[model samples]
Target: MRNLKRLSIGPIDLDVAGGEIIALTGPSGAGKSLLLRAIADLDPNEGQLSLSGEDRNAISAPAWRKQVMYVPAHTGWWADTVEPHFADLSRAHVKNTLQRLGLESTALNWQVANLSTGERQRLALARAMAHEPKILLLDEPTSGLDSENAARAEKLISEIAKSGTGIVFVTHDVAQAERLGTRRLYFYNGGLHEAAP
Candidate 1:
């Protein structure tokens, strides 16, 4: 992204290579989520955005979003059952993803309203990985989980990055950022800067 502008953020530039994970941290309302939303083209913004050399405008919005997915902090479920949210639960990779995230296969049959916040978060992450996006924008992905579950989610995210999927995740946990980020970025005074070593 070059000269990316959204709300009070940016006129910014950034590059996330495949297999790289960039962790973003800052105070609340610092526009970290906005930046991700803009990158995903979920909101109106001005910039020159592209992926693998193709301009974002070159493709339809839906196509662009599929390749650059934004998984918000709170996932929205349109269906009553969790099974309806996934395109195909039978795919081996999809099942594997769920298992790796410490989710049971039976959870898919449960009612969405009955699942806890942490369960929904893991399920949402699984849903995004199923699509196999080139880049993933995660907003506080492990916020609702305990230490054990958070570690599982972290492991899965690292594995995804190793497989050549670039990731930009926002987190309040400093230790989590240090563990997962190839580079740490700080959002301050409406600008993005390299975090102190």
Candidate 2:
């Protein structure tokens, strides 16, 4: 894929591609999330971002969102139970995703208020993946989980990437990036620099 011309986000410049897992890593306040937001068109900035050769400005916001799903670091659950949130999805698929993420089926019925941080993170991921968007933008997806659960989440992400979904994962964890990313984009000094393979 060809890298687009550098796009400006605040004071940063970034050029990236879709269809591959591009990990954004750097110290805090390096604008990793800002870069993702710019691509999502959630922020007003002077830059050009295109997906599958379609210019970002040419598409409706809702249309862009349908193809590009962004999962934030902290997810909010507005419903009392998870089942209702996933009601539109197939029960079997929901159950399988929960199981694969190391969550119990019973958690689907549990009150959202009662879930732990890790549980909520997994649920958010499941919710995002239920729609099977072509591109996924994730921010610190495994930060809330323990080592084992984190590994499970990573494996699930890997599997999703292998299935041909483009992923842009933002994380500070070097090992997670190394494992999940086909390419690495280091965000520093308000710009993205490609990392050595």
Model 2 alpha-carbon drift over 4 Å, by segment: 1-19
Per-residue alpha-carbon lDDT of candidate 1 for residues 1-197, written as tens digits (9 for 90 to 100): 99999999988999989999999999999899999999999999999999999999898999999889999999999999988888554567777889999998787798999989999999999999888899999999999999999999999999999999999999998998999999899997778999743
Query: Which candidate tops lDDT?
Result: 1
- In candidate 2, the residue pairs with backbone N, CA or C atoms under 3 Å apart (3 or more residues apart, or in different chains) clash, namely 12-190
Model 2 error, position 154 (Å):
0.6
TM-score of each: 0.97, 0.87
> Residue-wise lDDT of candidate 2 within 51-95, one digit each (tens)?
778887798998888778888899877788878889888888888
lDDT of each: 0.92, 0.79
Q: How close is candidate 1 to the true structure, as a TM-score?
A: 0.97
Candidate 1 off by > 4 Å: 88-90
The TM-score of predicted model 2 comes to 0.87
Tell me how far the alpha carbon of residue 23 in candidate 1 is from the true structure, in angstroms, after superposition.
0.4
